[model samples]
Target chain A: MDPARRLGPAQIDVVAQLGVSTVLLGGIYALVSVGLTLIFGIMRVVNFAHGEFLMLGMYVAFWAYTLLALDPYVVLFVSIPLFFGIGVLTYVLVMRGVIHASHNVQIFTTVGLSTALQNAALVAWTGDYRTVRPWHSAVVIRALGMAFNLSQVVAFAIAVALTLVLFAFMKWTHTGRVMRATAQDHDAATLMGIDTDKVYRLTFAIGIACVGAAGVLVSPLYAAYPTAGLQFVLLAYVVVVLGGLGDMLGAMLGSLIVAAVEVVGSYFFGVAWKEVFYFVLFIAVLVLRPAGLFGQRGAETLGV
Target chain B: MPALAPGRWVAVALFGIVALVPAGVRDAYLLDSVILILLWGALSAAWNVAGGYAGQVSLGHAAFFGIGAYSAALMTARFQQSPWLGLMLGVALSIVAGGVIGYLSNRLRGPYFALSTIAFSQVLLIVASRWRGFTAGSEGIPVPFRPGFWTLGLGHVAWVYLALGVAVLYYGVAIWLETSRVGYQLAGVREDEDAAEALGIASRRLKVYAVTLSAAMTSVVGTFWAQYVGFVDPFYVFSIDLSVRFALNTIIGGIGTGLGPFLGSLLITSLETYLRATFSGMKTGFAGIYLVIYGTALILVVRFVPEGLTGLAARLRVRSSRAHA
Candidate 1:
């Protein structure tokens, strides 16, 4: 590499650090986007309130930690099932109503749900930025000539593990197969004796569960606030779109790409322009290729 | 105009009552609330042009609104220009921005278009906050309180009249669009873009026109907002919350109807005012409780009454007529 382009030892170490952190960030992004993508893929309905669900999970963890003095990692077990049930309930109460409505109705229903949930949280939690300060939150480990936050590393490990588990479940399990069939073709799945509605509910629950897991993992790294999910949700939208809407593997890949862009772009152009850079990229991708890297043909026009 | 219908007379009577509100109500707070209601009514009506009639839901309308606010504020502050001139310039800029966003994102359907609008608005927000030289960054620019007829400092009553005038103008445009050939083409495009395009409706061009008109009208409201408030901040001017409010008002009032946005704005503003008054003394985050209500109300409205208040009224009117028959 040219000396100007080549990084010195210290600079290389910084790059390595950035790379590791970005991967960790990508893991979290993938976890968030996976659920969002899954919901869109199967139901063809974008869950605008998806981030609010993540926020709900964070609050679950927060309340557990505050009231019971439980570790956030420990609270994840409770939060995941709780979020799953919430998702199922939301589907039963709200999603089922708008499932067959016009595109605009579907969009606004979620948007409305999102606005409601976010404000409900604001009313309940008072918009305070609460964080779980476990002992490991501040701990940093040095490895490969670079330092990493212990909390971030643990979160990354959990995110990747959960993602793999989800992948395996979808690939090997009967319910997962049925869900996939439903996603591929709802009418066909219905004809094949699969309860498509049940599958949708389950899929939505599982998607929300993924967000709950992500929220638990991220609790130590970020604050729990009413609007905390807004930024992450926007990023998840970018990741899911970039990965090709409704493609799990693509969402994972897209998450990494987005994380890398954020980390590297922030490093290069400054933090303020990081979103600007990616949003421009998002618009470009939409304009140039509506169907993302891994999306099915005509998927962009599917719901419409 | 042809002989005015009884409903038109009723509308005229309503306008007469609204025009006399300032004289009857001397409370500054009450006057301010009414002005806000009028402003929101105008804004929502503007949004309805693109979102309701054209079926292009723009969640980033705050970008145009903020652009208008900033342009007007900057012109008045930096160059000591007349606000009316600045207002015109701001509307022009907003229309151009709207045209660009419309052209670029016109290919996207539904949620994708909404997402692009959001991204665009966020980008503008970041730029407005960072470009401190022009925007004064987050500290914001103040519109010098030049209290004159031309300078738009003619007291709260004058502002109410100005806002009401703008609201009426916007409502007129909306009604005109609803009844015109362009309106039919936009509706066709909204109903089925492929079918409309096949029918040679020039869907993209129609959308661009709708969005440009919507943006220009919204920018006019933005200018009035700047003058009324005498201050402009990027966060307030370009907030996604503002965009949501516009959509919510329209949706709640009734989408695609001439009187929907006005009724929606009135309901929401009155509800907000009432909630704030009742909860003014509460210490436990009661301030945001109304928003929670708004959100819940939005979901409920979309679920059971998607056509909103106007739809319900129409249904009721039809039912009454049937009963009479």
Candidate 2:
């Protein structure tokens, strides 16, 4: 009787749940950060409205599910393209003017954009937090000792897939080569007959589309509100900066580390202490490695 | 100058009329809104010193504001101190905090400063929310009705307006700062840091000075705010919406102008009042819609009338005066 009571089922489950939850959280972090890293890699613009794009994508999922009865994952087809168009529009109409403007104008314009988009969503959706639920259960896997939700699994799969696709494109494609060249030296790329404007438009669109996809994927697991994406967006900024402004590989590794710190700290202290953990991590990184975890000397100027 | 131009005398007269609103208007709700407008205007003007003049563009002045409110409230409520002493201590704390934040982002340009300020504000919010022993956590500490001439009460709206008058006095100081040597130096720093450095101006010192000054002024407003509202809460103090409104007030009126914040506040206040009156049920949604429209208006203004209302007034003055001659 003592042997049977020693290893309680609940205690075993708790240990297993912590391990599984931490890994799943890391996947979510990676997904949120990938697009941010891509945008920084090429344009060097911080995309302050990046979170707004995610919010818009959430609305897309909500509307499609509410109106058309489309699955949340199916809504991705609509969100990705729509967000990409908006991204291109943003790059062409707004970013073009402020590309060479002072830091004041850069921040002012982007902040202005963020405010506009956020308000637009507010007016449209009226601050209601909505969630899309499928007919069946979303939790699919129960392996070893813990269960995995369908949304989280799908989010992880999509993230990994997109990451691989982006990696392959950057390594092989001619247009991708031009993007790298432009990121390295804008004038040199222009002189080399590579159209930098087109590159910028595509890069920005793709980056935004990535967030759009992430939004749709996570709509099932998380409630979508006007300000839902804000916390993650802020965290993504910290991750991007920590990874080095424009380094893709740095983003993935940085996400893992940041996730580990956040999840582990949250477990020990409480859920509310998560932000404290991240801020401390950010400050520590800033103090010890000012250029970032993997940033080069000149990479300080990576993001505009 | 144009014949219809509201001259400096008229502006003075307008403020005089405004100062007597509590006496004139007996409604507590309307008077409270008036106090809110003035407070927001003062905070915006303070923000402009660092953001518009020094080009720091901080999105986190709420930290100082929140800290000041809590400090003042905590002291007056628990320690039984006078409001005036609490006010001074609040400003001092904000100055120190501002100095540290400004130093951290001193080397970084543009959005980094804004981002860091946001970070600091977030941290402040977290601390205020978590430190239940001091802050009372999310429930917030209530300042009781300690109504005395010096205690800063919760009952009389007149006293609140009077406390707000001190904020207006500081706004006067800010106007003076605009025309002074520090103002020009700050402008020089904003336009070209290297050129200012070459001209023997200590750009970093001016930036830190402006930001610290901004923090001090904002904290003073916060002290009065806590007293007027009879409470102090982290969300109420350190909200990003307040920060956005600070930037909006300055930008909508005229980004770098001395009187921009006043005009912007007047316009926005009137608009908000009217909206609340007419669309009370749908205020939040309406405000969201209005913000979108306002954003478009801002873009248009930024594109065509970048100099803002003050510039327009100045232009009309020039044209009409020339015509008269």
lDDT value for candidate 2?
0.76
Docking class of 1: medium
Least lDDT summed over 10 consecutive residues: which range in candidate 1 chain B? B5-14
> RMSD to the native, candidate 1?
1.9
Q: Rate the local accuracy (lDDT) of all candidates.
A: 0.86, 0.76
Query: Compared with the true structure, what per-residue lDDT tens digits does model 2 show for residues A2-65?
Result: 8776588976887678767766776767767878788877876777778878877777887899
- Candidate 2 collision pairs: A44-A304
The number of the candidate with the highest DockQ is 1
- In the order shown, the candidates' Cα RMSDs to the true structure are 1.9, 3.9
- As a TM-score, model 2 comes out at 0.89
Best by TM-score: 1
Question: Tens digits of per-residue lDDT for model 1 on B149-244?
Answer: 777777889889998898888878877887788888899988888899999999999999999889998898888899889899888888878899
Lowest lDDT block of 10, candidate 2 chain A: A295-304
